[model samples]
Target chain A: MSTGYHVAVVGATGAVGTKMIEMLERTTLPISKMTLLASKRSAGKTLVFNNQSIVIEELTADSFEGVDIALFSAGGGISKVYAPEAVKRGAVVIDNTSHFRMDPEVPLVVPEVNAHALAQHKGIIANPNCSTIQMMVALEPIRQKVGLKRLIVSTYQAVSGAGAKALAELAQESADLLAGKQPEELSPAILPAGSDKKHYPIAFNALPQIDVFAEDDYTYEEWKMINETKKIMEDDTIQVAATCVRIPVFSGHSESVYIETAEHADVAAVKQWINDAPGAVLEDDPSQQIYPQALNSVGKTETFVGRIRKDLDVANGLHLWVVSDNLLKGAAWNSVQIAEALHQQGLVHV
Target chain B: MSTGYHVAVVGATGAVGTKMIEMLERTTLPISKMTLLASKRSAGKTLVFNNQSIVIEELTADSFEGVDIALFSAGGGISKVYAPEAVKRGAVVIDNTSHFRMDPEVPLVVPEVNAHALAQHKGIIANPNCSTIQMMVALEPIRQKVGLKRLIVSTYQAVSGAGAKALAELAQESADLLAGKQPEELSPAILPAGSDKKHYPIAFNALPQIDVFAEDDYTYEEWKMINETKKIMEDDTIQVAATCVRIPVFSGHSESVYIETAEHADVAAVKQWINDAPGAVLEDDPSQQIYPQALNSVGKTETFVGRIRKDLDVANGLHLWVVSDNLLKGAAWNSVQIAEALHQQGLVHV
Candidate 1:
């Protein structure tokens, strides 16, 4: 509601960062000043906003001076280094990395699920994982009604979640494959997991692992879902498990989730709850062949939930299919939304 | 084992039928003569088996004359029409369609899971759904160790399950998209579901619905997972729910499964059970980044199980990642395995 505020976006050259700029343009929050921050390698590059050319600045500890809000998305390492520096300069930091999500002092926020938790943030707030954010939007209403006991989720993740380069790799490699090139002949340097040495082609394949491997035979991506859900839900006792997979999709993360509630739940009531929730759209009309699809969800801000049903024989079990643009709700839009919420709640100083 | 037995393969030249021929070449079942049958359109086309060219004949009432064992994979419509004809000719039919899967007289069989059910087959045996077969292969061993109470599965299925033309569409459309063509500009005559009026581009996208839409907002693919699971497990009381998704992968099907057992189970004990099973392979070493990946399981016959873990808060909940070549273990290989089982058990005769 303020006339204008100073906002700084880190990782300005990345996938989510570009979306943040777009969202900021359409936002009601008046941006009197904007700073585009990226690594030294991308410094001096210009991105146009509001018919004005803005040069990307190399982010340093001193970069956040006079900035009211800093959005960090330059991976966990960059976030760990620069997020605290931004907070020290009196900026409210909304991090889009896993570095601060599980931290006891950081408030993990999904506005629809836990906007109130944002009030307790000590300078830095954490954005939930892309797969987790979309699911939370779809399930929080049901959890409010029946009280969730357990959740099991499997994701169909897009290449864009990995970054712009990964998306390019999918497009290029796919073109190569169809042009009579062997899969092994095409060099793969950026899929399945970036840090891992070997890269498998994801153009016509599904990689079962996301992120690097972790203890207990689960990928770090799966662990992030398990740990972040507990933090966002504010319940360490809630049962959660996830299997993250990278499919050929260019945008949107789709998940198949099954939940058990504390009370016996009917599919109809749960459907009603999802349809009524903010930022959630119900597309569940199986009789007419209507449901959420990835192609239909791109560039959209709403979390689409459909295929809602109860377990055939379980007392209180329910199933849902959830999809959302990963770069939007999963990253940039969530960060911008949090900035909007903070400004509305008078939590930020201009 | 018999030295020679008259055999028939219905639905010959289809996706699964082609793989069935390859599997039979490597199988040990003795055959005096082999008969190939298909719809009238595909009839007279020659397919090679064991280096011999055999012409396909039109499937009709008399097509099963003197056949000892028959494998059917065309579709439900073909099976409902000609399966009884095969039975009337004194041949035992193993159908890979849903036509007779739920019938009281037909036995649903996964040779490794419930080969004993083959004994109750009046004349036709039902092969479980492609997605269901892979999960059962991975879970049945653990269930025998600790009884299963509930199951939730989300599948990343390949377009090849839709048939050969679908695979071509996915490849061609992907090429068209990267070449800067809009998906709508690329005509999709096949994919997602061929019978459905509308077609979706499977290139770089995920279609949440597979097969046709069924009652209760669940897809026929999802219903098949639920209904076929109970029949194969021989327990209508077990809880099951599924969301089937079609990804761009050309071959293997991957699933994220969560199960609750009747007794307390740990990840280690469950891992041991799967490692000990005949057809199940445990590839769950997260430290080395070893797990079941669709790229690695493309030409293999085994069902790969990995990412096994117990839910942090639930006493009996466990999660698993399962993948197998949908054309092989899910269909052709399982069908051929059933024939081998029948021959080994002295159930087939000329």
Candidate 2:
């Protein structure tokens, strides 16, 4: 535990990977060396760390040879191909993709919610969905105080979560629209789902679909939140439904979550629990018009919870608004937190 | 009923008023004459109606002297001050403001959901909130097939609903942000809520508060939706909860609505009812990726309902995605529809 560890960050040129490096720089984990891996297109690119320029390498099977911890965030395909190779090379791969999330052997980890589940991971731990991660940060504290029975969430997700290209698309499309050009004439190559054949403008419009549509008409993004929350909470009995939407926001993801607890929980008590929890901030002062704003949560690693109130008609129902930087707490910071937890428990091997 | 009518469009220079004029041209109502009325500042402006230019006149107590039906799209203050005067001058005011919506004398109408409510109006008929109108169009059909018990909605509203200045602010601030300038440096004079001291950029963000804050910490926009839904349905006991958010969308309003019906209902039955409803267009075939989108419904008057599905856990619970042009069906068209209803029923006096 005292020795320095070797870490490798996959997708180093991407949004979440860049934040992972930043989070690592502020962490107490003694990093002996850091390796940046990306596609061949981005290989040989230089990124600064500790005042020195380190070149990103093209990822391959041998990339994880001496790495103790590997954070994979390229995409589901890359993770499916390289994660096993990383694991075989003795690195504990923490995948930030949906590829291995539902694989029973892979434990979906949201450190605040289910860090203990990390002990059961077989060389690879899966990061929960961005929308799910933020909700878990806000709900776990309350769930611990009073059990959760049912949940409904509607997310206002950001384009940056789709990657750098989508963010650029929004900027360009917005500029074109303001210039009086037809929005349709402006090519949409990045969103609402990049891999989906047709793209829609995200500049001043909301795309209700996030990720690809799955069976039962639920998008993969919504299914991730539903399934990941259950796996992270280890409660298959909890009823969960999600409507994940892509808004024009560039960074933070905001959610309006309604929950019915097993026990009737008072708003004040739940607010107190959220305030007392680590990595959770309470911004629910209605009198002062204080509530979480996506604009304010950018670059931050904590989940901002606000607008906590009991339902007027349903005795056990409570509603809350949760906001957090999807690239940070929802991805990079959460991945780094898992590595930290694993290191503290002496679970990582070189 | 067969004869042409003399229609007066109050607040003719405003957002909804302008749209009302456009809708009237496309509507089945035969207009013998069209009068455009506005405040002193907007007087002398010319608007074309049916290939003829009509000069805008300053609205006064005597403005409605020869008007058969007056469609009001002015603010609540102007509606309160001038609606009675218009009624006294032999015109029936179809008001698109909240000033008279909850009044015992004024019937809150969504033409599709409660056109019959218009028959109860003495002299003025009130239009429901933009968010409520869209939801009611999607849900009333379900309510008819299977009685509605509770409704929970979270809205992704557009900036145009706030007025022209707010839309301009959003555009200006967006341009500032693209130039790498701070949003605060742009000086937001109107947004989130115009009367509120603080304003946030809606360029790429979602503001949870739409109107001014009301009792129970809900925004006035949220309260208006809740109260207006009950009054329009004439069911005080039906539970409704709303979370209204202002997104960067310019025109269309989108909502994620969850409902519980008194009787057990399947997705197919619900879809059929919505498809057959007067103003509702079902866009919900999930397999082909056919679903309601805000961009598609921007200038359209139809309320698009899609993603209708039964909840996995609750037998009576259903989820729907509703979208409509906030200025059209939610305001202008509804106002004009009331005018048409009034003229047909002999409620208007020329």
Q: Please provide, for model 2 over A38-157, each residue's C-alpha lDDT reduced to its tens digit, 9 standing for 90 to 100.
A: 999999989987777999999999999999999999999999999999999999999998899999998899888888988888899999889999999999998898899999999999
Highest lDDT: give the candidate number.
2
Give me the overall lDDT of model 1.
Answer: 0.87
Clashing pairs in 2: none
Model 1: how far residue B171 lies from native, Å? 1.7
- lDDT (10s digit) by residue, model 1, range B115-143: 98877677888888899999999999978
Tens digits of per-residue lDDT, candidate 2, B176-281, equal 8999987557787788878787777787777888888878777788889888888888888888888888888889999999999999988888888998999999
List runs of model 2 lying over 4 Å from the truth. Answer: B1-3
The native-contact fractions of the candidates, in order shown, are: 0.84, 0.55
Query: What are the lDDT scores of the predictions, listed in order?
Result: 0.87, 0.88
* Predicted structure 2: lDDT: 0.88
